[model samples]
Target: MRILVLSDLHANVTALDAVLEAAQGRWEQSVCLGDVVGYGPDPNEVTARLRKLGTQTIRGNHDKAVAGVMPTDDFNPVAKAAVDWTRAQLTPEHLSWLAALPPGPLATDGIVLVHGAFQDEDEYVFTPAQALDGLLDSTAEVTFFGHTHHQGGFSYQDSRLEVLQIHPRPTESFAALRIEAPRRYLLNPGSIGQPRDGDPRAAFAIADLDHQTVEFWRVSYDISSVQERMRQARLPEPLVQRLMLGR
Candidate 1:
C-alpha cells in the first residue's frame, strides 16, 4: 500500500494541488497531518478540496483555534493575529468540520499519523532528544508527524537512535528506510504552507508500505498566489512575507 503523507496545508490550494498532481496515480491513499487552515488565503477552498479528496486529516492547532476549541492567547502576536483573522474567514460548516477533526497520533496499518508530538499535538518535536522522547512514548512501529515545518525522521536500531535531517535542494533524492518487524519510528513530512527550515518549497513524504520504504519529498509551488491571498484578506503582512523566505 502506498500512502502519500502530507501536512501543514495552511490554506494554500496551490501547494496542495501541486502535491496531489505530483502524486497522481502514484499512491493508493493520501493522509494529511492537519493545519488545513490559518496563514493562507483559501481556507474554505482548501478545506473543501481536502474533504472532496476524502483524505484522512486530523485537527491541527490552528484548526482547533478556528473551531474555538483552542485558545489563541498562547500564540505569538503575529500567529494570534492570523488565527483571529482565520477564525472570521471560516464558514459555520467549516468551523464545524474543524471542530469535529480528531487529534492524533492516530495509528493505522504500517503507519502512525499525528499533527504534532504524541505527548501533545501543539508541542514541538524539533530536536533529536525531543524526537527520541516522543518515539519512546509511542507504541506504533512507524509514526509520521508534522509541526516543526521541517523534514526529518528518527530511527532506532537495536537500542540506538539516529536522526535524519533533510536539507532542501533541487533534484534531491529521498532516503529509503526499511521497517523491520515492529520497532518504533517517528517521521515528519515537513510543512506544506509554512516551511520553517529556511527553504521556500512545499514539503511532503511518501510511504510505500508494500516495499517497506519511506521517502521525503519537497516541491516548489506558486507562493505568490498565497501572498496575494494574504494581502486581500488583510492577514498580517509578515505572515504572508515569511512564506516567501520559508521561515
Candidate 2:
C-alpha cells in the first residue's frame, strides 16, 4: 500500500490543501507525524480536516503545548504567542482531540512514526550524531520523524551513516529514492504548514511500501493568503515573514 507521510502541519490549511491536491489518488493510507495545529491561522480548521481524513497521527511539541500536555516555557516568544492564539481558536472538541493524541514512537506495519527522536518524543534529531544515536538504538528499519522541518534524514548501513537531502528543482514535484534492505533510515518529510528547508514550498513524502521506494514531494501554496490571515489575527511579524522565507 502507498502511504502518505505528513508531518509538522502547523495549521496552514492552504499548504495542506495544495499537498492533498497534488497527491490526490496517489496514497491509500495517510499517517501524520503531528503538529496538526499551532503557528498558523487555521488551527481548528486544520485539526478538523485531519480528523475528517482519519489521519493516524502522533503528538508534536506544538500540539502538546496547545493541548496543555506540555508547558510553553521552552517555546520562543513568537511560538508562545502563536500557541496562545491557537489555544483560543480551538473548540472544545478539537482541543480534546488534540489533547488525546498519542505520543510516539508509534509502530505500525513494521514502520515507526515519531515526532522527534525514538528515545524521546520531545527531542530534536537534527545532527548526524543525534540521528545515528537514534538509529543505533532503534530496532525498526525505517523511522519517519519530524521536528526540525528539514526535508532530509540519515541512513545507517554497516555502522556507516550518510546524510540525505532532496533539492528538487522548481518544476520537479518530487525526488524518489529506493528503500534498500540491510539499511536503516531516519526520514523527515519536512513540514506541510511550515517548512524550514530554505525552500518555501510545502514538503511531504509518499512511501510506496509495495515497491520499496520513498518519494519526497514539495508543493507550492498561497503563502500570501496565510500571511494575510496571520496578519489579521495579529500574530508576530517574524512568523509571517518566515513563511515567505521558508526559514
Candidate 3:
C-alpha cells in the first residue's frame, strides 16, 4: 500500500493544496500526524479538506490548544496568538472534530503514526538522542512523527544511531530513501503549513510499504497569499513573516 504521510498542516490551504496536487496518483491512503489547525489562516478550510480526503489523523499540540483539550499557557507568544485566533475561526462542528482526534502512537500495518514522541504526544524529537529514545521505546519498525517541522529522520541499528537528512535542491521535488527492515527508524516528514528547516515550502512524505521505501516531498505554494490572509486576520507579525522565511 502507498500511504501519503502528512503532518503539522497548520491551516495553510494553499500549501496543503499544492502538496495534494504534487502527490496526485502517488498514494492510495493518507495519514496525517497532527496539528490540522493552528499558526495560519483557513483552519476550517484545511480541516474540511483533510476530512474530505478521508485522512486518518491525530491531534497535534496546536490542535489540542485550539480544541481546549490542552492549555495554551505553555505556547510561545506568537503561537499562543495564532491558537487564540484559530480557536475563534473554527466552527462548532470543526472544533468538535478537532477535539475528537485521537492521540498518537497509533499503529497500522507495522508502521506507527505520532504527532511527536511515542512516549509523549507533545515531545519534540529533534536531536539524535531523542530520536534514539523514541525508537527504543516504540515497538513498530518505523515511527513517523511530526512536531519539529524539520524534514528528516534517524535510524538505530547495532546500538548506533545515524541521522538521515534528505535536503532536496531548490528545483527538486522529493528525496527518496530505501527502508531496510529489522533496523528501527523514526521519521519526520516535516511540516505542511509551517516548515522550520529554512525551506519555505510545503513538506510531506510518501511511504510505499509494498516496496519498502519512503519519499520526502517539498512543494512551493502561494506564501504571499497566506501571509496576506494572516495580516487581514491580524495574526502575529512573526507568524506571517515565518511563512516566507520558513524558519
* Tens-digit lDDT track of model 3 for 59-136: 999999999999989999989988989988899999999999999989876689989888899998988977876788
Instruction: Please give the TM-score that candidate 1 achieves against the real structure.
Output: 0.94
How many residue pairs in model 1 have overlapping backbones? 0
Per-model TM-score versus the true fold: 0.94, 0.98, 0.98
Per-residue CA lDDT of model 2 for 26-51, tens digit only, reads: 99889999899989999988998899
TM-score quality measure for candidate 2: 0.98
Instruction: State candidate 3's TM-score.
Output: 0.98
Better of 1 and 2 by TM-score: 2
Clashing pairs in 1: none
Candidate 1 Cα deviation (angstroms), residue 74:
0.6
Q: List the residue pairs that clash in candidate 3.
A: none
Pick out the ten consecutive residues of candidate 2 with the lowest summed lDDT. Answer: 132-141
Q: Model 3 shows how many backbone clashes?
A: 0
Q: Give the per-residue lDDT digits (tens) of candidate 1, residues 1-247.
A: 8998989989888988887887788788888898999888888889998888888888899999878898888889888887888788888998899899999978766577888878889998877778876677776677888888888788776788878766546666355566665567888888888888887788888888678777777788899987887898888889888889989
- Candidate 1 regions with alpha-carbon error over 4 angstroms: 173-175, 180-183
